[model samples]
Target chain A: MKARILVSFKDSVLDPQGQTVRNALHTLGYDAVQDVRQGKVFELDLSGISKAEAERLIPEIAGKVLANMVIEKYTWQILED
Target chain B: MKARILVSFKDSVLDPQGQTVRNALHTLGYDAVQDVRQGKVFELDLSGISKAEAERLIPEIAGKVLANMVIEKYTWQILED
Candidate 1:
């Protein structure tokens, strides 16, 4: 099975790296851009598992090792492989 | 209008930041994690624009100021108010 997971800070959270990017954008002349938030993308290849199993299993994986739940939230999708 | 965009290096491309994260994970005791890739996410609140217009225009925005074509690729989706 294959999965693509995206984890990010919610809108309400402050992102220092994103603020830096926004500042850089302004310097680069993209003034229309008002805000930027940075996140992590994980593309996983789990050969022995089924997509159904992955969906159930990944939340635990994400909770335990993939994301810091205090500051991050995640969503995942099963991929066609 | 609201739009969410995500930008990342292609799987074929090497990610130094991701590698760093994987190394950190190993040190923190996530031995099952083989790799990690980092990316950027943008949650845009574009007022005075229609979702349709935002979707049509974001490709140009992403291409011009959001991501470097040589190193990154991105996808965007319209959001409910």
Candidate 2:
């Protein structure tokens, strides 16, 4: 099994990096782009674990280590490999 | 319309950060986690554009500005709002 976690800033937080990307796109002629948000993706390879176990583990792992709850939130999914 | 771009290092590239994450997970008692790979995600909001036009623009934007073609690979999808 494999697990994927996406960690991103909450909607209320300011994302300066995303803003910079939007500005860069404008300079490059992509005027249609109105907003940009950047986030992190973590793919974990789980060995010798059942899907049920992985499902239970992912939340704990993502919550405790992968995301900063004060400003960032995370979502995770398990994949069959 | 919205577009999501996922950028990750090529499989052949070394991911020290990922290794660090794996090590951290192991320390935290996640023994089933064998490996971890880190990547980036970008969500862009498009305004005043048709789906076809947004589709055409996503690749150019991801390839030219969001990802480093030499060491990274990117995948994108368009979303309806």
Candidate 3:
């Protein structure tokens, strides 16, 4: 089994990195860009685990280790292997 | 239009951050985790662009600004608004 996880700042939290990127885009003349949000992606290879175990572990791993619940949120999906 | 870009280190590149995370997960007893790779995600809201223009610009933006072509590779998809 395999899983992909996305960890991003909560909507209410300020993202200075994203703002910086947006400003860079503006400077590059990509004027159509209105907003930008930056996030992290984790690709996990759960090669020896069963699908059920992987499903159970993914959320726990994502929440407990991959994300800071106060300012960041995580979403994950099991990928077909 | 909206575009989501993913910038990841090429397979040949070393991902020290991901390795550190994997070590943490291992310490937490997730032995099933065989490998981990970390990447970046950028969600861009292209409010005023037409689909054709967005298609043309996404690659340009991703390649030139969002990713270091020498070590990182990027992929992107346009989303319906």
Candidate 4:
């Protein structure tokens, strides 16, 4: 099975990288741009877990490797592929 | 209105950052970690545009400011306030 994960900083978090992207685009003359926040995407192939087990296991996976809960938050989806 | 944008490199893309994060996590002793792909998320407070207008505008926004189309792919969503 494969899963897709999205990881991001929580609301109160400071995102310098996002700011840089915003500035880069603004400098490139895309002035209509408002904000740019960046995050992570993960595609994974799993072994030894049924789809049922995957649903059960992923939250723990998020806590384990997908995110640093103290600073970031994440969401995941089991891909049909 | 607010919108969330997710940006990532295409599958054929070389993901050095992802590899670095994976190495970092491994060094930190998170061995169960597998693939660590990185992406970007954006949140924007859009003014003067209705919710409907936002939905229409975001794709262009992604194309213009959020990502470099030659190397990255992206998706976006409107946040419900």
TM-scores vs. true structure, each candidate? 0.74, 0.96, 0.96, 0.71
Ranking by DockQ: 2, 3, 4, 1
Q: RMSDs, each prediction?
A: 3.4, 1.0, 1.0, 3.7
Residue A62 error, candidate 2, Å? 0.8
Q: What local lDDT does model 1 show for residue A31?
A: 60
Task: State the displacement of the C-alpha of residue A33, model 3, in Å, after optimal TM-score superposition.
Answer: 0.5
TM-score of decoy 4: 0.71
Candidate 4 chain B minimal-lDDT segment of 10 residues? B28-37
Which portions of model 4 show Cα errors greater than 4 Å?
A20-36, B19-36
Q: What is the per-residue lDDT of model 2 for residues B1-81, given as tens digits with 9 covering 90 to 100?
A: 888898999999999999999999999889999999999999999999888888888999999999999999998988676
Pick the winner on lDDT between candidates 3 and 4: 3
The residue-level lDDT of candidate 3 at B63 comes to: 96
Can you give the lDDT of residue A36 in candidate 4?
65
Which of the numbered candidates is closest to the native, going by highest lDDT? Answer: 3
Cα lDDT tens digits, model 4, B1-81, are 677787889879988987886786668654545666677767765666577777877888788767899999988888864
- Two-chain complex of model 2, DockQ on C-alpha atoms against the true structure: 0.92
lDDT per residue (tens digit) for residues B1-81 in model 3: 779898999999999999999999999999999899999999999977689889999999999999999999999999776
When 2 and 4 are scored with TM-score, the better candidate is: 2
lDDT-based ranking: 3, 2, 4, 1
Instruction: Give the per-residue lDDT of model 2 (tens digit) for A1-81.
Output: 788898999999999999999999999889999999999999999998888888888988888899999999998988676
Question: In model 3, how large is the Cα lDDT of residue B71?
Answer: 100
